[model samples]
Target: MSDGWEDSADAWVASQGEEGDFGRRWVMDAPMLERVRRRPYVRALDVGCGEGRFCRMLAGEGIAAVGIDPTVALIDHARRLDPGGDYRVEAAEAIGFDGGAFDLVISYLSLIDIPDVATAIREMTRVLAPGGTLLIANLAGYNSAADAHGLGWVTLADGRRVHAMDDYLEERTAWIEWRGIRIRNWHRPLGAYMTPLLEQGLTLTHFAEPPAHGGDPARQALYNRAPWFLLMEWQKPRAGSSSGPTGRA
Candidate 1:
């Protein structure tokens, strides 16, 4: 795969210091991890695995996981930081895996970055085992970076800062460069994200809008300013498919 974004992603993730910090706190909660643990999936895929934080988390629990990202540096960092799990440099729209290859496929906050998100979702469904589960949690809905003034920057070619927020009009690609690294972060309404799943025959099993970490006043203010998080569980509908636990919103 031709990856032009590798080095910047590495530097950006490395800049984050640890596997559990940075902006991921909103998505990687204890309750969410527990939900993943109790699921029936044995084989899994983490799309846009970034530094492979969650992949390593899943591996630590003994579930076999393959983390895929088009950015080579991110994959390399994931390998170096989390040695036990598998990591690959591959595009979300073109994951080089066989059909029905995974019992679960997860895309954390990474979904909105891919330009052809619908195609990626379909590919995820195509490679998912019958009755497999797809878990997506991220900054979506009325809550998005757009509301956070993220729409103003331009991301450059070295993967830093080149495209502006208004550039998202293309529908297939959208990202901004921070410093010099290109970060594909697109913000869309909740329905825009969930509609594809329903069209692809995936049933919504759970939805959540957990209150932001309540301790920090600044965070609480931002949480109130925007919908900071939304978690949704989707399942490939089939007879006898287990209905998972419903979470609070």
Candidate 2:
């Protein structure tokens, strides 16, 4: 959600009740949390922490977590739901926190929403402490259709369902509007993401286009045909390290 986020905040929050939408609840949560569990982090930050969901999750795991978002309404909701949580209204492109402040930083499904991704990524990397982890869960490039007509299964001429995609390599914005939720999300090729992080000297620790688990059969098939999300773990280089993360996978 972008400039219109205030109008759509309630619906977005409602769509993700206690768990999240299908992608977050069934697909991304387990693996994302698993990656978090792999390393011990004393302090963590959630870059686009909508409603403080992931931040609360990190707190549950005994980590001191802080959440930041550009939407004031969403931050208000987050503070209401999580009274003691640290929820701030801040943009990812320019985090107010001091550099090297967080041991673990996450940008969960918020990368596509930020209009200035390069600056946001830089800020996320800046807040990360040496040897810290930046775990990301993002929509697959194909999912953010340029036309924004929405991407899913469609019956072909032979009556076989296929996911149609026209521009996989194009960087564009998709105005996603549905069921009272309207937000602008960006679509970029893998290079649009990878190159910047690599330039920052961040090491790729783990990457996966993991499948959904223990869900409706039909839904699983749909997700398999064209993955809705992918997870990536990048580690900031320590002062003297020349290699990647200690636990590479």
Go through the candidates in order and give each one's C-alpha lDDT: 0.70, 0.86
Off by over 4 Å in 2: 146-148, 242-249
lDDT of 2 by residue, 138-224 (tens): 998877753455465577899997777777787887667876888877889988999788767888889999888857788777777
Worst 10 residues of 2 by lDDT: 240-249
Best by TM-score: 2
TM-score of 1: 0.77
Native-referenced Cα lDDT, model 2: 0.86
Model 1: lDDT of residue 175 = 48
